[model samples]
Target: MPTSQPTPWGRARGAALGLVLVTVTAGALLGGCQQGQQRQQQGETRRQEQALQAAATAQRRDLDALVERCQAGQAELVTAAAALSAAEAALAGLEQRRYSPLPRPPAPDPAVLQRYSISDQELELERHQQALQAWEQEERGRRSRWREEQRQERQRLQARLQRQRQALSAANPAVLSPAPEAKLNREALAAFRSCKRETLASLGS
Candidate 1:
């Protein structure tokens, strides 16, 4: 018996089906690759965005810290300046009083002293002694008061300077050296001391 051969149409149908399966498989693989690439891109973009947000947060924190320091420094400066002015005023008053002390009693005329009787002379001597004692007492009290005031003013100035130093220390330690405001505060402290010394010398003179 002769075997029947496959029809041409049947072979063509088989070829077409095979081609359709190959194309579908290729499309599926290409879609998977594209999806993977998109996922990778998305991940990379997320990382970049996170990095930017972190940097911005850090920058804002630094700026806030700087502003706070500046404000604190300004407040300290104003307080110190007011203290300095008060110290200066006190020194001025002390100096004025020191330079112009109580007036001395005038010397009695020699003729008048001789003309007076012995009893009268004794009474005059007693009165002169009393006046001298009173003057001395007044001078001592004034000097004591002046010394006390000077001591108090010096303490105030020193305390203010100490506060300024503390403030400077509290500021950004990341900065290697003193800032301009700190330098200015130091200069002010020096000037205050110099003024105190000069005023004391003037008082002494």
Candidate 2:
């Protein structure tokens, strides 16, 4: 029987060895594929982390800028509050003194004098003083036709008064009472007073 086929045990051992080799080779191939897939996953995870970190950095910068603006706004509010308080205090102080000024006195009449005596010589002196003032005011710096009109008016009054004095001197005391002379003198005095007022007012009294 062909040497009993070299004992079937030997064939069995060879088959077993072949099976073990195939199994080990398959295990090594699977392990290598798993390792490659793991490396790919790790690379993708790293890329995702980097993208997240970049986005977080941008958001942090934006938050920092917003915080800075809020701080600046708070400082401005403090300044405005101080200014408003100062203005309110000033208004309050002014309100306290709003009604404390003294009342004004009445206007004085032009004919009244601050002196003690009344005489014709003194009155004539006052009239001459007024005429001198009018002349000085007209000559200082500049003049107009209005000043000439005032001068002419004063001259006419003076002439009329001179004529009245001559008439009084020539009149007889029995024929004419002094009443008419007194009336004429009063009228002339009133006209002279009005002329002084007009002159002073025209010169920005």
Candidate 3:
């Protein structure tokens, strides 16, 4: 037996159904692609966030280490300053003693003077002058030596202070801030700024 041919309306309905199926399939495929793109974008955003977080953490650790070093340098500076002050005081005392005049000897009685010297007091005056000269010579030598020692001490302390200052400057958080070209999120930037402020305050800079 021969099968009956489909009517125009039936054929049209079938075509419409096929078109709908095609449309639905296309729509599903497009939706899937959009969803995949969205997921990929989310993953990228997560990665960027993670990287920013890690950078911030590293920055904090670096700041902490630098601050520790700066504190240690400051302590060393304090010790050096104390030592310098003591050295200066000692030098000053030596200077005062060196400059101080010796006590003048009282004049001898008339009887003793006649027995020691015939008429002129020039002999006694010469002796007194010679003694003063000798004392001054000795004192000048001591002062010169003390001055040299003080100079050496001062130079040593000054060098130590300079080194400490350089160390502290190197450890400055502002100097150590992240690169300007770095892509950081708002939260990470805020964290970095906060850390810098705290570090500066702790270092008393």
Please provide, for model 2 over 22-106, each residue's C-alpha lDDT reduced to its tens digit, 9 standing for 90 to 100: 9999999999999999999999999999999998798667555544543444444334334434544544554454222232233
Question: Stretches of candidate 1 above 4 Å error?
Answer: 1-3, 75-205
Compose the digit string of candidate 1's lDDT tens values, residues 1-205. 9998879999999999999999999999999999999999999999999999998798667655544554555545445555545655655664565435778776566688899999998888888888888888998998788788777866776566556444434542221136444433444343333334443233223
For each candidate, the alpha-carbon lDDT, in order, equals: 0.63, 0.52, 0.60
Instruction: Provide the clashing-pair count of each candidate structure.
Output: 0, 0, 0
Best by lDDT: 1
lDDT of 3 by residue, 100-182 (tens): 44554554456766767554566776776787778778778877887787778667755654444344334332322344322
lDDT of 2 at 20: 99
**TM-score for each prediction?**
0.37, 0.33, 0.42
Show model 3 residue runs off by greater than 4 Å: 77-205
Per-residue lDDT, model 3, residue 98, is 35
> Which scores higher on lDDT, 1 or 2?
1
TM-score of 1: 0.37
After best superposition, candidate 3 residue 20: deviation in angstroms?
Answer: 0.9
- List CA RMSD, all candidates: 17.4, 37.2, 13.7
